[model samples]
Target: MGEDLTYLSFRVIDKKGRAHILEITLDTNYPKCPPSISADVPHIFNLDWSGNSKLKDAVVQFEHHVDKLQDFWSTLDDIDRSLWVVDPKDPHFAMSYRQINIGNDCYITLSVNASDPRSLPQCRFLGSDANVNLLRRKWKINCKRWVKDRSFSENLTSILDIELPQPPEVRKDDRQTECGVCYAQYLPIDDELGSKSGSATDYTCENNNCSRAFHSVCLRDWLRSITTTRRSFDVLFGNCPYCSNPVAVKIINKK
Candidate 1:
């Protein structure tokens, strides 16, 4: 009676939008020995093939009526489509919202390469120097909780709800502040009138995590190392070394 039957491989997304890779193989002695079903997501399906009559009955049903198995998979797919909303505007839609805004001017941008739901998404923070540092620290503290939950939407919600330390007060005399890049205290340049130039030490990173003031010369040198100049003009555009956010620096024209 056993004529021809082959194994089936399926890739499916669950209600949570997590993909599950599965393989169902009908044994040569199928009805006598239950079919083997293996899945990448162990929680979704488990088999007890230890001489269980129910297992044999299930396999026989699957063999006799393949539609039942297909129906089960289709149900999961439908559930996935209904629950997972992939919209860029919705912060709760993790797959769609690549950049998450958690108020306080803080942002967490997900890496495009992060496709696995089980793995923590590689992300970087953007904001004022203070907020960036605050978010980064928070992320480090709660990353394991996200992994345990394995729900992107839940993770986003929790991060946004977390309370962070108050941003430190801005220093009035930041002229002699140490440069975040060069690690040297800023020194004002002399003006034509032989007075300290106010703008000389004003080049501070806009990133909330790094309000470190830098000499224009030092900043230019640092920016140049990370980017190439444009063909027509000496302009460099790149992410901040600390935050990986867009930054543009132009070569100062010497008179």
Candidate 2:
């Protein structure tokens, strides 16, 4: 293979919060290993983390396309045994493999991109160029993939969705007269049907007129019934449900 192979290295975090440095060797001896076929493989190296954590819970999975070698081992009893017999030079004999280790979890996947390059009836060794090139390029790409753990300071803006120009303060409006039944505020009702109760509450709706109030459980039940039945209320007590003005019923969520 000589200089036909290329090598790539990657730093991976396993499930145990341990870091692993992996090296992959690719054989770039084939014509199919050009940039066109390998572009998609490089972008798959991105890392996504759900929250503050250094370890990955699962092993990496690999996927690839098989161009040929459709029936190279149709008559073989054992697939692994047949793999050893297939000629490497076959253009239809494309190969892609990936291995990942996450703590104690490990996985290995393999596939073919092509089969026979010669297009001959009998199996023929097309040459070492294609096989070596394909392997080298694949290994080179995979070994370069890495995932890094980010700190809160580095990712705070993204998590909060806004930059802090000043320190956050406790707003006085956050507190409201919570209902005794449900211990929630008497706010606008999102649902219109089902259980409803006449109660006094201080919670206001987005619409200024609708000043209706209700126990939390009553409002919750009413909303649930309306949603389940897919119905709407026209007017509540002859006033706007939200602004309490002389208007029609509008759905609002009772806090």
Candidate 3:
């Protein structure tokens, strides 16, 4: 098989706490040609010469595009500016967004061009054609400034100010019923939806001293992965995934 094409991927966050996946590709004819770039949803990249000349020149003229891309990724990581909402544990590229002015659960991808690290990236939407068109139009009218200054850190600081400049608003209910395994509030319906149909609802760690709750699916998976002496035939039991305490599973029927 032919060697895979050389490319790079980045996880960047916008001012609205939205995460984007930036994929840059350099073909065999690179330097003589500009590198290709793309991003995730509500795509509004403008790869035209006027907006993305720097990125074009960087890939076309310099043989160091590889190093430059790595440098850019390092910068985002060091500044703590990379987007994490998609996959909190490890950095794998996926698309999702929090509720914003536009709408929630609207998936879109931004196809962008990055010539150099400093020059603005030019992008346009690539997936869910109708949604992308609508989003691009809205972005062009209201978020021109935002699109023009697309540096990862620049947008991150702006979002941090808007989202956490003040203390987070704590919900009384959440405080009382946070999931111990994920330290997140249990959403029964969401748990049910994620689990095998009619299997079980979410679960709670049954150690009286450890009142942490967990999704039944999460607990089962954890039990399967961890090494433990507690077992019945092939079944396995282990300490609470959260606290290092003994735990028992309580399967709730889906409502």
lDDT of 2: 0.29
**What lDDT tens digits, residue by residue, belong to model 3 across residues 1-255?**
125747766644332212345567765666455567765333224433333354444434222333234333333232222222221222222211211111233422222232333333333433466766665675565443443345543443342222222213334333325544445554445544444443332555443323456656566655655545256654445565433345554443445
Candidate 1 clashes between residue pairs 3 or more apart in a chain or in different chains: 128-207, 128-208, 128-209, 129-207, 129-208, 129-209, 129-210, 130-208, 130-209
For model 2, residues 1-255, the per-residue Cα lDDT tens digits are: 225445444444322111234344443532223111121121233233333422221113211111112232221112221122222222111233212111112121223222432121111112256553444454445433311233222232232232323212324344235542255554344455233434445333322111234453444343343312233462232221122222223444444
What TM value does model 1 have?
A: 0.31
Candidate 3: deviation at residue 22, Å?
Answer: 22
Model 1, residue 140: distance off in Å is 19
The TM-scores, one per candidate, come to 0.31, 0.14, 0.25
Which candidate gets the maximum TM-score versus the true structure?
A: 1
lDDT value, residue 233 of candidate 2: 65
Residue 140 of model 1: what lDDT?
82
Q: How would you encode candidate 1's per-residue C-alpha lDDT over 91-134 as one tens digit per residue?
A: 21123125545456666675432123334567877789987887
Q: Tell me which of candidates 2 and 3 scores higher on TM-score.
A: 3
